[model samples]
Target chain A: MEVRDLNFTYPDGTLALEDVSMDVHAGEIVAIIGPNGAGKTTLLLHLNGTLRGNGVVKICGRRVEEYDVKELVKKVGLVFQDPDDQLFMPTLYDDIAFGPINLGLDEQEVRRRVEEVLSEFRLFEYRDKCPHHLSYGERKKAALAAVLAMKPEILALDEPTANLDPKSVRELITAIKKINEEGVTVIISTHNLEILPQIADRIYLMNKTVLAEGESDKILADVSLLERAGLL
Target chain B: MHQEIDKYAHNSPLCNLDPRMKVISLMTLIFSVVLLPRLELVSFALLFSIALLFVSRLPLRFALHFLKWPFMFITFFLLIMPFSIEGTPVFSVGNVIATYEGLKYGVLIALRASSAVILALIMIATTKFGTLLKALEKLKVPNALIQILMFSYRYSFTFAQEFDRMRLAARARGFNPKTSMRTLRVLGSMAGMLFVKSYERAERVFWAMRARGYDGSVRMLSELKAGRRDWAFACFIIAFAALLHLVGG
Candidate 1:
């Protein structure tokens, strides 16, 4: 996926993004690190057309602007930072089942996908639980499951590691790596520089604009540059 | 947060009763209470005492404090009745007369309302909302309707929380928004934002549903059947209501 030059403003008239541009190659994991109020969320929202902008966004080399949402929604799954926002369904099963159903899959196929992801995430035991009652880690897993159930080719996550315990972070990263290994391109926006060492090969630094993009190691090496861009 | 009524209400034996049976019992009792033009002292005593017995078994006192409002209203109605209606002047006022017809009407309405409210309260006090949905699901209520009710109830708190956060965020941002025009605009924007947010959420939830492969039917786990206890309770309530109406009449 590639963004030419994205621009957006909140309805309250905050100019959130301006001439932001980036590219995510197929089968590659891309990470965007930025500080608060840096238009990270607004940019992330634009990937799935949840938030639209001026310039072009191409998913799988196809212009996201021209792709039908019904088809695009199936190709790129957006996971928000808060599990509460994502996992709004009553049960883990239903939460996971939601995306597949909306895509108009058959019943058996939806159940199969739900069961597959539930077991994959080891959340089979929590199939019947309400998301609100789950522990934060489990809720996050359930939220991911909700998106993953759609079986999107590209997984776009916002702050996947926020508020997670160390073990949960490791587990989440491992699961994400496994999914990446399975050929699902992972695009995540987070400040966890430590995470770059494990999963991300390339890093994009955004501070109200595209400040830097390169190999992960090179990005991490420039501490002053990172700090200046609100990414350190 | 006020504890959800369902969380505490589901443990009672009354909750385990078949919804059909409970529905039947409620219908019979309400009918008897409403049809008996004169709630004889004995029938009224039986219904009130039976309801109190139910109240003792369920977590109703805390689950539904609103139940007390009816009691107060009933008392107020009874107290004011004899003073308002005109019939044989039972008592003389400075320039008005209080009559026996008012007294009879007031007490009857009070008794009927009390009995019906208590019965309904008992039903709600025992059954959790989730269990009620399960029952409805089993009874073949449209899954879509149950789902809507379930999500609405579940997310109403989230809505309030979001609204509160927005209010605080606005206040901190120096938008005091107290003047009528500003308040109206801000509130209108909030309503619009909330509607958009909720609509978007509904869309996301639909995606979540589709991802789960929900091809429409809501297949719930195996539900408890109308066992002996459910039927027994139903029978006892029906018999009691019939006996009340018969004896009172």
Candidate 2:
């Protein structure tokens, strides 16, 4: 996936993204870290044609606008920060099956994928439960599972580990790693600096724009750069 | 989340029964109760509802708790009837006169209302709200209406939780509400904030749905199927309602 000179402003004239540009290779784990009010989420939304900006976003060498919204969604599954937003269906099983069913898959395939992801996230027992009943960590996992059930080539997550306990954070990192090992390119936007080196292959320190982009060690070791981005 | 009835519904002995069957059967019973011409037949309807409540295994106190509101409402109307209708005067209070006809009419209305309410309560208390919505969908209810009901049922708890949190935050700031304009203004602003927040959340939720390939219609994983026992339960309830209607007529 590639974004070139991306610029976006909200309808209220808030300059969200300015000349933002990044490239994510297939089968890579990319992390975009920034403080509050950064444009990380805006950039992720552009990847799946959910938000249109004044730049070009190409997935698999084709411009995002060229593909139908439904087709684009199948290639890039974007998970929101709030599980309540993502899991809007009545039950967890329905939420997981939502994507696959929309993709025009058969009922048997949809059921199989739903069951597979629920078991993978250890959420099989909560299949019939609603999102409000799940714990914060479980909801987060369920949200990711809902997206993964879509079988997207690129999985973009917005703030996957905000407000999580240390244990949940660790488990989420392991889950992301497992997903990455399965060859799905992962893009996460978060300020949780603790797990970057363990999970992220590359880091982009962003504040309304990309301030620094490099290997995780190089980016994490740069104290002055991290401080400049207000991430310290 | 205040889901007392929903909690009971999930754990009730009749929870596993097909919701479509329960809805049809219980609705037929309620119609019979409402259509009964004689007040004497109401006793049978009340007894039938009580039997259903027993079979459901819901706590007696919990089932009766739902009757409190209907009782209060009926009592308010019943209070005016004794003085309004002109007939054989049973008692007199200055210009106000109580009549035996008005008293009997009030009793009949109260019995009919309470019996119907209990039967409706039994129906809802034995089926999960989501399952009930699906039953309604299968029963030829409009899709848009069913969707509205589904969202309202799901998010009412969320909004309640949000309201409680906002109230707690106000209390933490040493805010005390009383019958004053200032209190009203504070509450008004809180409600406005909640509306705005809900709107923003709705927009975000729509985008999330769009990201997951949600077009317009909603699809679910579970399908309801009525078994032999469900048919038996429905047949028995319908037969009992018909019997009551005929015997009363």
Q: How does each model score on lDDT?
A: 0.78, 0.88
Instruction: Give lDDT for model 2.
Output: 0.88
- CAPRI-style class, candidate 2: medium
Give per-residue lDDT, candidate 1, residue A188.
Answer: 91
TM-score of chain A of each: 0.97, 0.98
Q: After superposition, how far is residue A39 of candidate 2 from its true place, in Å?
A: 1.6
True contacts kept of each: 0.19, 0.71
Model 2 misplacement above 4 A = B80-106, B178-180
> What TM-score fits each model?
0.74, 0.91
| Candidate 2: tens digits of C-alpha lDDT, residues A1-232 | 9989999999999999999899999999999999888899999999999899999999999999999989999999998998877776667888799899899999999999999999998999998887778898899999999999999999999999998999999898999989899999999999988889998999999998899999999999999999999888
Poorest lDDT segment (10 consecutive residues) of candidate 2 chain A: A83-92
lDDT of 2 by residue, B1-249 (tens): 464566687778799999999999989989888888787888778877878888888888887787788889989768878888889999988989999998888887878888888888888878877678778878887877877876776677677889999999999999999999999999999999999988988888889989989887676655899999999999999999999978976
* Top candidate, metric lDDT: 2
lDDT measured at residue B221 in model 2 versus the true structure, 0 to 100: 53
Q: TM-score of model 2 relative to the true fold?
A: 0.91
lDDT of 2 at B7: 67
